[model samples]
Target: MSLSVEEVRRRVAADWNGIVDVLDEKIALRSVSAEGIAGENMERSARFVADTLRKVGVDARVEQATGADGKPGAWEVIGEKIVDPDAPTVLLYAHHDVQPVPDPAEWNTDPFVGTVVGDRLFGRGSCDDGAGIAIHYGALEALGDDLGVNVKVFIEGEEEMGSPSFIPFIEAHRGEFKADVIVVADSGNWAPDIPSLTTSLRGNATCDVHVRVLGHAVHSGQYGGPILDANTVAAMLISSMYDREGNLAVPGLEGCEPIGGLERDVDELGLRADTGVVDSYELAGTGSLASRLWTKPSMTVIGFDATPVKDSFNVIAPECTFRLSVRVSPVQAPHAALEAIQVFCEEHAPFGAEVKVTMLEEGMGWAMDPDCAATKDAETAMAEAFGTAPVNMGQGGSIPFIPELQRIFPDAEVLVTGPEDPQSNAHSPNESVSVSGLEKDVVAEALLLDKLAHKPEPTNL
Candidate 1:
């Protein structure tokens, strides 16, 4: 039987306290997966997620993965509830990993020790994905045992570490995670009060660049005038990635123009990023700010290995390395974009310096088709839950697994929505989720599942 919206609402409210408790329990575990950080907490968190799902009438287990580096990777939780074989299936995705807490002092409250301040719940992973985990479980509880549709839940354990093992892990368990529609609860809405359906996302490619100008270090004071310095050469190459107006200078990359109704406040974004831009500090790139951020390709020098400012010597460095992160447009293929970046760097190196680029990680972007019937149903659900129509928005950030999921389930309609808002501050210190926002997500997802279940059987891919 199809559950009514009122039933979903009542179930969400009734399970509110229990949902909060689950979120708090997750935040309390410092499940970080960065280098030098422990993975024991990640494993524990994965187990916790699996156990929680088991209590909600789902069969769940934690599966260990093999990392991209060919070593042991983090653990992931996969759960399934099959209502009927012929019913449409919905795959819910979220991550259990949290970013490393760089400094405990930076957080107003203990990052792992969550605190409720009025409408907000503050903690690491509180909004980023912890809220998502709760939303899926809460929605299932609302639907009861006979959901009218099959549901599959995937809670990844190393998303914050860039999801290096995502493809391999999903490939290994392809049949178990198959579904007709995928809902990725990992992105944010446009604002705290406003909900949005993420329609597109940027792709990304990363590489390490090495510039060799000299065979060995030379005395800067004696040979600095004529000989080239690897550090200087590397900086110049990096600088060439941007134009005088700070737009990406790489040629042959494509960009999609922003849809007519999408807009974001520059000041609000600056405040969220904590980057105080002066009035005259013109925004980078061309087209609308939304287009520039979400649709255009951009580059960032994420890391560099040169002489440290604290331990600098009066010598010319022999070689320098810079890690380049290229954000590709949703319409561009990651491999092509990565190759362009490599070719551009090698061709533009200054002073005939030897340049080489080693590709690190590359993933394609995703865009939802506008004519899908599932999208209309999703839009209606979001509108009903938020009391306003959801904007078809584009996210500047990339989710590596989203595109992979698209490839794995070619006919599935991928809907990206989450409890996060601009103020959630995900991945930053003091991350939090609105108590009301989470409740709304539970309502929307539960309604979406119910609505889709009543539709005609899904078409074959």
Candidate 2:
């Protein structure tokens, strides 16, 4: 039976109030990553979500998983059985983990205490991901027993730490967690009031570059001019990564196919305002905003450690180290990218200085094949919800678990969408969500489930 749009909207409206209460209670507790709350508090957060699932007639369990470092890394709460066991299942993914609250003085309210001002919910995890959890629960509750397809909810506690333990956990229980579709709710819409499906994510690789120009530090006044300064050499090497046009000059970096149908004028204005770049400064070498940000590989010098800027600076620094982060194309191999970066740093070092490069972390990117049946269903549902076809977008940031999820379920259609907007302020102070945005997302998710449950599976790409 087809559910009436009005019926679904009503269900979502009723559930939205309850979801806000649940989110408030969950956010009131401090679940800062690996800190603030450990042991019992960590268990408490897991239990809270699990129990909520159970109360809504879903079979839920909390499972412990060991980390790569051999620590009790994370716990996952699984909610199961939205439809017949043998039917195709969809995996709904979200994270309960959150970053630590910075200085209390920086926040408008206690970071752990949920506060509501106007339509916005204020809290540390309010927009980053706690809202994601709430949305999943709301969609499931709104659908209730009427849901036609099987759905499984997997909420993890280690997403804030790059989800190191999740891949292992998924590997260990692949049989029990098989799915036809994976709905990753951890991402946001490209802009407010616009629904977007993230089709590509840029892979990430981090490395530290160390340059030693001399055997020992010397007085700058004595050895300044003729001596090779390690800091200057490091600066030169870093600057070489980008050309005068701010285009990445790394060899073998591939560009993405441009996405049409986007308002280029609006995107450029938004990018400039968001990035705070000077109006006169041309926005880099770009074919399209989506192509430059999503398809093209980029490099950033995240941090540099050397002699302190304070105190006496008369001495010539003997050594300098810089932390570099590279965003690779979805098709690019992270290890290969790391090797290329290492070679570049070694070959480009100035003045024949000794340069050592060490990789810190590497992860592959993920891209969804938009030709899949689930993709069509999701797009249809989103169009129904928002009155227009959803934009196929790409994310510049990497979600650590996406590639792993793809590897674990190669045949499954993965879809990434959520209530988050560009102005959501995720992972920063004063993060918030629009009530209407949440409403639209809940409706979209419910409609997606309905559409997926009834649609015929695609026979060919």
Candidate 3:
């Protein structure tokens, strides 16, 4: 029997309570990366998801993928069944991995323990993505007896580490997981009550700058002034990458143009808050927030490791290194950006210090065609479910698998939306998801599946 919207809502509401129970159980297992609860915990979470999918009658399997470091630490749990092999398939994606919970004392409750306070469920990964995964499972369960479309769900375990194994896995299993549409539910809405469809993700490239000035550490009393401090040289070169106006000074980096339909005030405030800087600190660059965030190129000094500050006697350090993370425009090539940053740093080194810049990792950005029919259908479904229009947005953070998926499914439509709201506090202490948001997401996913399943074939671009 086909379920009405109200019936679906009711069914989801009933199922969500049980889903939360499962989420609590999952959270209690502590799936933190590279810690005490790393691989085993993630595997258990995957098994739980696989078992849940099986209970809903989907043929589920766990596929292990090697990490970038050639470690066998990552895996993807896929649950799929092609009811009609001739029908177009939709691929649903989410990650099962989570960031390590540092300092559980900072949390109101144990970081590994899911706590319900008022209308929200709080824990690590609860809103960052676990909520989305739970809702995906809930939606499928709601449609149990009346499954209408062929769907494949892929939950990865290394998204926290930039989805290192996703591309290789997708390439290796291309034919087995073919889909007409890919729905990524890892992003959040624009605001607490508003619905948003993420259409763009900024690319990420990381490079390290090492400045070696002295052959060895020398006493501050002996070589304080003339010895050429490696830390000072590194700091100067690293700081030079940004102009006095707070704009990136890296050469060959291209800027992006703002897309229409996004508001400036909202973007400005949101950017300030997101960067953890006060509104009084005027951000460099002119134009819309989207332009500055998505289209614009940004360079950041992520960290610096050298001599310890606690040491009593200062010395001319032999070497110092600063890690830089650059965000490129969706259209810019990562290798090109990496090279530009390296060349600029080397050329701009201070006082003839020996400088070395090395590319650590690179991932391309993605820009989805918003005018596509799948995007439109997703908008329609979201609007129907939330009783509001869905806004098109861009994420400054990079999801490494996004560009890969775009390349793999060149002709397919991709939509990124989820149950996360701005207040979810994902990847932070007190991470949580609203009960209302979870329910709305289930409704949105169910409606989206219904709409996409009935929609006409998309024309090739």
Q: Report the number of the highest-TM-score candidate.
A: 2
| Per-residue lDDT of model 1, residues 1-461, tens digit only | 56667778888899889989999999998787774223677788899999988878789998888876778887889989988998889898999888878988988888998799888999999997899999888888877865878889899888887777888988989998888889999887766667778878899989999999888999999999888789888888888778888888787767776533455533445643566667666567666777887778888889999989999989999999999888889999988988888889888888889999999888899887766878888889888877887766887889878998899889889899888887787888889999888888888888898898887657999
Q: TM-score: which is higher, 2 or 3?
A: 2
Residue-by-residue lDDT tens digits, candidate 3, 155-199: 887788766577887888887667888888999886656688886
- What TM-score does each of the candidates earn? 0.89, 0.92, 0.88
Q: List the residue pairs that clash in candidate 1.
A: none
Instruction: Kindly report which residue pairs in candidate 3 clash with one another.
Output: 256-295
Best-first order by lDDT:
1, 2, 3
Q: Model 2's lDDT to the true fold?
A: 0.80
The candidate with the higher lDDT, 1 or 2, is 1
Could you tell me how far off, in angstroms, the CA of residue 297 lies in candidate 1 after the best superposition? Answer: 0.8
Q: Lowest-lDDT window of 10 residues in candidate 3?
A: 258-267
Q: lDDT score, residue 42, model 3?
A: 77
lDDT against true structure, model 1:
0.84
**Candidate 2 minimal-lDDT segment of 10 residues:** 257-266
Maximum-lDDT candidate:
1
Candidate 1 stretches with Cα past 4 Å from truth are: 1-4, 34-40, 66-72, 216-228, 259-273, 278-280, 310-318, 456-461
TM-score for model 1?
0.89
